[model samples]
Target chain A: MYVAVKGGERAIDNAHAWLAEDRRGDTTVAELSVPQIREQLALAVNRVMAEGSLYDPDLAALAIKQARGDLIEAVFLIRAYRTTLPRFGTSIPVDTARMRVDRRISATFKDLPGGQILGPTFDYTHRLLDFKLAAEGAPLAPTPQAAPDMAPVPHVTALLDRDELIEATPDTGEAPPDLTRQPLELPANRALRLQALARADEGFILSLAYSTQRGYGRTHAFVGELRIGAVAVELEIPELGFAITIGEMTLTECETVNQFKGSRTEPPQFTRGYGLVLGQCERKSIAMSLVDRALRWKELGEDFTGAPAQDEEFVLSHADNVQATGFLEHIKLPHYVDFQAELELVRRLRAEALAQTQPSPRAAAE
Target chain B: MSIMDRQNWMGLLARARPADLAALLPDLPQSQWLRPPEVGAVMVQGRTGGSGAPFHLGEITVTRCSLQLTCGTVGHAHVQGRDRDHAHRAALVDALMQTGAAADLQARILAPLARIETDARAARAGRAQATKVDFFTLVRGEDA
Candidate 1:
């Protein structure tokens, strides 16, 4: 019974005009430039890029401006823009092992090679507001140190792999299914699941990951290692007969070691859950790893405890904020005709019920 | 030059700042567009456990173009971001690298860009190096 009604052309236009004015906010103040948003509000840009599944900082900044700082709306804008571009090809999987390590740390091991570098993090910063930053002057510069000729840091999991204490991650040598190109299929492979979780909404995944720690779907996970840095992205050039570096991007990676008992066919070994995300999104990456482990219960021969995180369809279907928001927001649109139909039906049913309960005029006279 | 050498120079050109590349190579040799510079995207992939099966992480903007020099040396360039001029300059550099001008271009263009990249990397390394933890244990009075 859904019927289209058209008449708000002028009203809609006026609304949009007002929205634009409000988005600018207080004409007395200076305007916000795209570069300012890109550089100063970097974490917001990172979140938009990660969730939007597009990594153009400029575009993300522009979206943020247009959306008036509504991050999910910014993500929606980026996603819309991304679908219009022609995809050239897929890049060769980036080598994180050779990444220029900016921040590398391990919670499981006290002493590990490539000793823990904190890099530029807010982990130790006090939560109190800095009123000085509210002023326009530049903040104090960070202390510089002599550059060390550092060796390539190896993955912390390599140590556990040496003695077969941790399960080995063998190269599958297969092209993974592109979730963007295909509809989400249930019983998703690890590769497909990881792809979904990488671009999944940060807040949604964070909560799901948090649930696991609260014993809903406990995996007894430990953060094996977390590293964030720039890595070169290489692509195979068919004419050149070899791969060449196209560019580099900042990536945050987390590997979680989860507890596992020996199954009937396999020996006892620590299981691993992996997460890799665009930019320096450490929180999202760590959360992704935990949720990733919880979802692996079936493959690891663990019990299906009916936890929300363990349900693949449930997690993947609802993880996308853009999709969730669109569906949720559509209800605000005019459902007038549908509601009217329901209203008439209910009234008719009510009258019929009353007629059955009470006698008609002719019956009463008889 | 060997394929390895070509790779090194092409990578440098691809990653160079557009303004930097433009400043270095002001005059370009006559060339015809085999494929005009077009902006597109490349789906970047990452592995499952940093070294396992591959999975799609995200897409990055990449501009690509192909061109042929007057001497019949054809070259292709694919660089990240949506700068058509950057891609064109990169392709020109690629074509020039195969010609008699290869050594001159390397000295004038590639060397400076490489230095800039190296300096940036060093600066980033220095900042991270400052934060490397040096752990120590306190000696107990009784044990001492």
Candidate 2:
């Protein structure tokens, strides 16, 4: 006998109202404005923009506020909103080589053409909670520094390429598949895999990259270069007979030089794994490069050892935390009918077993 | 001019000093908005390293404005970030530049901005040159 539980509709409505109230908290303190989130909580906005694949700071800030600072949820809001908008035409590739770099470092060389710059980073910051931030005080302004020279800083990989030590990346002229538009298929190409890793959940990618470092996929890597800066984005307007610089964005680009074994036709060479992420997401970008290197095993003629990072289908499918979370949490809803059917089957089986185990009273007398 | 050169000029014009532009044209033609200045985003794409199949890098905020002069020349300006006034001024200049009326003001308005941009670039280059390094290793006796 199964009785369906009723009155969930009203309960849910009340819960939602309570949730709204909770989100408001004490209205005595001033409510957080979108500009404050956009400006003050910039890193959160950056993460949402990066993961959501939309670059609007105001919307991201609003999403952050609506999601109560849960960055993943904020990303989800932005992602949902993005689907409603139409995409304009694609712009020409940004020139990072000409980037007015804020922070640039190369591990392969002790000193490079443009010297290493250690910009604003939390690397050496003490993790102490600042009580001053609790009480409202005007934030201190940053001292301005002179702009970086307008010159192309050669990539560290270019030095290795001179001796044919690194693999050359040639332009294929074919449009790479957009993972957002198409269903992810198995044995995806490099471009598609890169796209997946780009907007893939940062924490998920980090763990996979960490797994590789622990000898799961084991591609020894050196940080060839890590650059954080503003790059110009140019767009072509055929009607205008020229392309124009539309905007600039802050990006973190990481390149990993990994060891590759020689094959029949090719000599042993250091292969490259590239990652370019939005904002100053150093850890995510570095992790993305490691995962990228691990995924290149097939193309580089290395045998797959069934590692998590090496599995294309696994990484690409599970990388989206939104999908993973929804599927994992959906089991909490409505299973009463299913359980009732199982209950009936079990009761019938128990009765049959009891009848078989003990003889009836009439049979025993006979 | 090559597209690259023209782009450079447009960039200069977009960032030109407002006072200088105003001084160049004391009395400007009244222009009506075709598309008023609005903030939006432009998705930025990039190659792996200057040469590879294109990949999505990220998005940057942009303000685009379009205006038409009374003489019917329409011009558009799409500049980076959220400066509505800059976008509008650039659009006006673009409209004026397309018309025959721009002949006298082009040099008067743009030359100073161009010089400033060039000087800024040179100064930046000089500062970076101060940090330029040349690395060399000493050979040990045994190796030699």
lDDT of each: 0.91, 0.77
For model 2, which pairs clash?
none
The estimated TM-scores of all candidates read 0.96, 0.82
Q: List model 1 lDDT by residue over A1-366, tens digit each.
A: 445678999999999999999999999999999999999999999999999998888899999999999999999999999999999899999999999999999999878988888888999999899888988877688677756645788999988899888998988898899988999998899988999999999999999999999998999989999999989989998877888888888899999999967877878999998989998899999999999999999887899899999999999999999999999999999888888889999999999999999999999999
Off by over 4 Å in 2: A1-13, A130-148, A334-366, B1-6, B9-43, B58-66, B79-90, B100-144
The prediction achieving the highest lDDT against the true structure is 1
Correct interface contacts retained, every candidate: 0.77, 0.42
Cα lDDT for residue A39, candidate 2? 95
The global Cα lDDT (0 to 1) of model 2 is 0.77
Worst ten in a row by lDDT for model 2 chain B: B124-133
- Over B1-144, each residue of candidate 1 has an lDDT whose tens digit, in order, gives 899998888898888888899999887778999999998888999998899999999999999999999889998899988899899999999999999988898898999999999988888888888888888889989989
State which candidate has the highest TM-score. 1
